[model samples]
Target: MAKVAIVMGSDSDMPIMKKAAEFLDQMGIDFEMTIISAHREPDIFFEWAKGAKDRGVKVIIAGAGKAAHLPGMCAALFPMPVIGIPMKTSDLGGVDSLYSIVQMPSGIPVATVAINGGLNAGILAAKILATSDEKLLEKLEAYSEEMKQSVVEKAEKLDKVGYKDYE
Candidate 1:
């Protein structure tokens, strides 16, 4: 049973949404991914969103560009946490998509991240799930330590090599 549902409006979002999947994989979180356009196929999307909870999906990470209704629609139908990733668009540089997800009406809230922020979305989803699972919480803590160590290693190299020699 998947705890997270990773959905996007189109395949073009694969590049961005893959980051979320990669992070979830590292955290040992199971997720079901699919491309479902809320506008083009409302019936299918609606059914999927409504049945997500029954299917064991506790969180949803939705990526969409342009109008970006996928995330908001999922939030509206699914009674769980929804994290929206606004893909960068060539037209407005994803401002349109960002606004659409963030400006959701009262009583319906979609937690949105920056344009193309799939990794953060995945981390946020993991944090939400970790509230009830001690093992997952420990994994999250170790992940944070790993990230901190990576930065420390980079900083040490930069200090030793100096800015000119660092690459």
Candidate 2:
């Protein structure tokens, strides 16, 4: 059973949504990814949102552009954390989507990440799940240490090759 559900408004959002899938995969987290446009496929979207809890989805990563109603709607229907990844649109460069997802009603709140922030959404989901799962919590801690180590290694390498003589 998947712990996370990655939903997008269209397949065109795949390039952005895939980052969430990749992060979940790295953590050995099972996830289901699909397209369900709130505007074009309201019934299917509603069904997915309503059934997500029964389907074992602890967290939902919803990526959508334009009006970006998917995340907020999911928040309303699903009684779990919904992280919104607003894709960069050609018109407003995702400000419209960001605002739409972030400005949910007082009762319904969607955790909105930055525009095109799929990986952050995935990490946030893992962090939320880790609060209950000890194994996942350990994995998250190790992941954090690895990130710290990676940055230290990068800083060392940069010291070896200063910007003036970077080649």
Candidate 3:
């Protein structure tokens, strides 16, 4: 069974949603990806959200642009964590999407990432899962160390060759 479910309102959201899927893949986490629009296909959306828990989905990442209610609605239906990725839209520069997902009412809350922040959402999902899975915790710790090392390497190179010429 998949541990994570990545959903989007449209195929256009795939470029962003793919980042989350890639991260989950790197973490050796199983996930399912699909397109489900809350507005266009309400019944299908409802069924997918309702059956997610039984399908062994521990976390959900939903990406939507304008009027981004997919994540919020998924949170309403699922008891587990739902991370909302606000895609950059042609209008309002995605602020609209960001606000729509983040402004859920009391009791129902969705963890929101920045606009086009699917990668961060994926990392957060991994961290959430790590809280209970020791193996995942180890992988996360190692990944963190690797990132720190990359930064250190970059800094060393910058020190060797000043910022003006630095690539």
Candidate 4:
């Protein structure tokens, strides 16, 4: 099975990046993680992305804060899908990162999640992979249904107890 690569620009992003890793682990999806800054180490980023396909990486989840270019750069270098998770930083509160990731040029598209949306990135990658694998597609469908059921169950319980009484 081709695994996912979880790359972050800095160690500070680990806390946010870990959420994606945890989600992938829960889904039984293999993933590898590393810290590589696009601005500081462009060569390393290019090499890693170029070699990702041969290394059996089907998808990449990249997280970065200000001026986030990791995901866009990877998308340009690799043909595989790239999911961008914008991390919240002090300066721009992640708006800069969000725009950097979402505004990709023609021919290269990077799917971007909300700020600090690591979990969603992981789930999106799984959905992409499920397009080809029947078993994974089934699992993804079941997961979505389970989430719906959980929300419905919570509403039912709230109705039975009444919100005022619970409070």
C-alpha TM-score for every candidate: 0.98, 0.96, 0.98, 0.94
Report the lDDT tens digits of candidate 4 across residue range 1-167. 45899999999998888988987887888888999988898888889889998989999999988888899998998899999999897998999999999999999999999999988998999998888889888888889999999999989989999998753
lDDT of 2: 0.93
lDDT of each: 0.97, 0.93, 0.96, 0.90
Assess the local accuracy of residue 62 in candidate 1 as a C-alpha lDDT between 0 and 100: 98
Which digits, one per residue and each the tens of the lDDT, describe model 2 over residues 16-92?
89998999999999999999989998999999899999999999999999989999999999998999999999999
- List CA RMSD, all candidates: 0.6, 1.0, 0.7, 1.4
Error of 4 at 10 (Å): 1.0
Say which prediction, candidate 2 or candidate 3, comes out ahead on lDDT: 3
TM-score: model 1 vs. ground truth:
0.98
Candidate number achieving the greatest lDDT relative to the actual structure: 1
RMSD of 2: 1.0
Give the Å error, residue 104, model 4. 1.1
Question: What ranges in model 1 sit over 4 Å off?
Answer: none
Better of 2 and 4 by TM-score: 2
Residue-pair clashes per prediction, in order, are 0, 0, 0, 0
